[model samples]
Target: MDEDNIQDDIRIYTERRWLRFSSGSYFPVYVLLAASYLLILIYFTIGLFKVFPCGPDTRQWEYFYGKCYYFSLETASWMQAKARCEEKLSQLVVINNTAEQNFIQTRTRNDRYWMGLTDRDREGTWRWVDGSDYNTGFMHWKPGEPNNDGHGEDCAHVWGNGEWNDVYCTYFCYYICEKPLPIRIKGHHNRALSVP
Candidate 1:
């Protein structure tokens, strides 16, 4: 009985030693394969997120659809600023999303700026001078901001923190504008439409 037990123990020890030696040879290969897979995954993920080629940096401007969108500027009164923007081959700039509002607010060194929004035509119905509805995507107002100081305050101002607060229409501040890119439709049949 003792001899048989000794032989069993020896056999188990030999098997374990062989397994360790063989597995050691393959361990490095397994590690290398896993590392290579990880590297490939990282490369593809970064490439997928890379931005497409655009034009030169316009600072606080976005060049899209053959138009230059400008932000972070100063002007006096919503009415006067709208007139000024119109004169610049543009209109009062609209903040379409939070990304745009954040971009404008970050670029601005001033305390405030005028946006193309107001309740001038109606008391509570805010509208952009471009005749667009006030879609509340990027709008961040201080608590109770549009309490419209009686009837005199119809215009809107963008604060340093990018919040819209209703101020007197005649108040002065910087403003943003959007200039449509002059379209020179080449190829007689293809007309390039200036859109967002």
Candidate 2:
């Protein structure tokens, strides 16, 4: 009888040991899975900024010659358009290279538009309306350009093929504007993006 009782006690103890061991082992696996889920959630939330996917206000801007551009302003005269852009703390669009000129031509709907390049200061010596000196060799002139026709034609206009032609300063036309992008805000975090 003594030996029988001892054997029964041994069996009970072994069964209890297995039950306790399995419970402890499975607990950690559950914990690991939960931790993995939490990590995935955190990574996804931080990776993508919360800006709207696409719209007029959330639109991305293009850059040219290290300058940022906006849609062409359709309202106002060439002079008034230039003044309006300046009032917005920007300047009339000053295209730098062939690629930029091509881009504006693509973006604009009107065939004729005003740009920063003008001959207003010296009548025949074309200069950027913003007073930036011309360094590149990307001149798109209509045939017989810079004729200084009628003596006071100091403004510049883009023709259908993206060519520049001298015109009177008072003539009105659509214009482009440029300004620095505002800082992006994402759920209390300030995000910076490289301009494309």
Give the Cα lDDT of each candidate.
0.70, 0.68
lDDT of 2 at 140: 71
> What TM-score does candidate 2 reach?
0.60
Per residue, candidate 2 scores C-alpha lDDT tens digits across 118-176 of: 76666567777656676554677789986778868787777677777787777767777
- Best-matching candidate per TM-score: 2
User: Model 1, range 1-196, lDDT digits (tens) per residue?
Assistant: 9999999999999999889878797689888999999999977744532321121223445655445766544557778888887775578877777676677677655477887888877788888877766765457777898998775789887885777789998888888777655343456322333333
Question: What is residue 34's positional error in candidate 2, in angstroms?
Answer: 11
Error of 2 at 169 (Å): 1.6
* Candidate 2 Cα RMSD after full superposition onto the native fold (Å): 8.2
Question: Cα lDDT of model 1 overall?
Answer: 0.70
Clashes of 1: 6
